[model samples]
Target: MVVKSEFEKLGLPTISVELGEVELEKEITENQKETLLKNLQDLGFDLLDDKKSKTIEKIKNLIVDLVHHKNSELKINLSDYLASNLNQDYNTLSNLFSEIENTTIEKYFISQKIEKVKELLIYNELSLSEIADLLNYSNVAHLSNQFKKITGFTPTSFKQSKDKTRIQIENL
Candidate 1:
């Protein structure tokens, strides 16, 4: 809504606006682009102009959405899901993501999942088994192993400890 309002305030006709993307009725002028960029920056949003950067951001957004928003388990593999959504080959997407982000897509996805696990642990509303099931892990053991590998804290230990540390999704 903020993005849409910004465009409307600038007298730009937008066909649609979604997270990380916007479709305008027509091309925006250089001045309009500059104004939009400035406005978005003021709102803590960066306008990604490069195709590679945009694609990378899209990938990150999709993974974040999948882990944080969707309640159902992923029926297909991550690569297939990403390729189908982005209309690009998995290898190409993986290569581009790795080159730019200095991390594999799998690693990034795991990091997001770990962040979600941290959040769930902090909430203390679900058991480890429930969290594993909710996150589509094979079992509590698997979740515990991965959680320990990434965070150096077993889920139980993290939950029991005085300080519970969680990283921001964007920082991952």
Candidate 2:
């Protein structure tokens, strides 16, 4: 809504405005682009013009949505899901993501899942077993193992501890 309002204030017709994306009814002048860029920057957003950067951002957005918002297990492999969603080959996406992010897509996905686990743990609304089930882990053991590996603290330990550190989704 903020983005849409910004464009509307400038009298620009927009077809759609979504997280990390916007569709304009028509092209604007370079001056308009500059003004929009400045406005977005002031609002803590950056205009991504580079193809590779946009692809990376899309990958992050999809994974974040899946882990944070979706409530079911992924029916397909992550590679297949990403490829199908982005309309690109799996290998290309993987290679590009690794090159740009300095981490494999699998690692990033795991990190995101771990973050979600942290959030659920902090809420104290679900048991470890339930969390494992909710996150589509094979079992509690697997979730604990991955959580320990990434965070150095088991879920139970983290939950019981005074300090629980959760990385921001964008930082992850």
Candidate 3:
């Protein structure tokens, strides 16, 4: 069984969850690694090299954790965090992410944040002020502004439209 903690060294901050054991004594072969890599590539991420793939995976994990976990308070300033955590200059990391992902890291970060806001809106647990605080926005107004900018509708409008259409996570 592969312990969840085994992924700790990958360096994306994650809460320890009680993942049940799933035993597989067989070691992953080179071909299996290639196949896994191919699957990830098919999902829109281009795996350039093992080192790049690892770095990209770390970024993906952080983004997903930020969006999917309500209790997760992600450091909103991703550039500074990425620079320090990945041990690279912000410019370098941003450039590589933009080059390979064909989108700026800031755009990706904002997209993830907006997705999270959508999820919160769906849950109807937190008020706009609370959601803004949770997401580390300057204020509810700021959150609404950004949310409206990325998505055509205002937060309130988005909430109203929820019954009509729910946005899917993968589409974001």
Candidate 4:
């Protein structure tokens, strides 16, 4: 929405837009591109133009969609899901992600899932088993184990404690 408004402000047509990306219907001049990039950077966004940078951004976006938006049982393994969505080999994608982000893709995916779990827990709308099932965890024990591993507290303790701060999704 910001991108659309910003582009309209610049008299450009926003063809498509999503988190961390935007597509213009027509090519803009270099000066316009610089101005847009600067404006977006001021608003805490980046214009990912290079191939590798765009790939990395796509990976993050897909993971976010899977973790936060889908909210249902996964029909396939994450590796296959990513591979199919990206139309690339899983090993290649994993290597590129690790190289750029300094973390494994699996770890990134887990962190995203854990963040979503925290969100659901904070909302107080779902049981632990439901949360686990929604997030594709095999069982509540597995979910609790991972929650403890990443957050240093079980789900119940996390809910009951007075200080239940969660890491920002961007940080994860």
| Number of the top-ranking candidate, with lDDT as the measure | 1
Whole-model Cα lDDT of every candidate shown, in order:
0.92, 0.91, 0.67, 0.86
Per-prediction TM-score: 0.94, 0.94, 0.67, 0.93
Pairs that collide in candidate 2 are: none
TM value for model 1: 0.94
What is the lDDT, from 0 to 100, of the residue 164 in candidate 4? 69
Better of 2 and 3 by lDDT: 2
lDDT per residue (tens digit) for residues 71-121 in model 1: 584545999989999999999999999999999999999999999999999
TM-score of 2: 0.94
Prediction 3 TM-score vs. true: 0.67
Residue-wise C-alpha lDDT for candidate 2, range 1-172, written one tens digit per residue: 9989999988999999887888899989989989999998999788887899999999999899888888574545889889999999999999999999999999999999999999999999999999999988989999999999999999999999999989988888
What's model 2's overall lDDT? 0.91
**After superposition, candidate 4 runs with Cα above 4 Å error:** none
Q: In model 1, where do residues sit more than 4 Å from their true spots? A: none
Q: How many pairs of residues collide in each model?
A: 0, 0, 0, 0
After superposition, which runs of candidate 2 have C-alpha atoms over 4 Å from their true positions?
none
Candidate 3: the clashing residue pairs are none
lDDT by residue (57-133, candidate 3, tens digit) is 56655565655673345644677767776688889877777777888877887888888888889888999999988
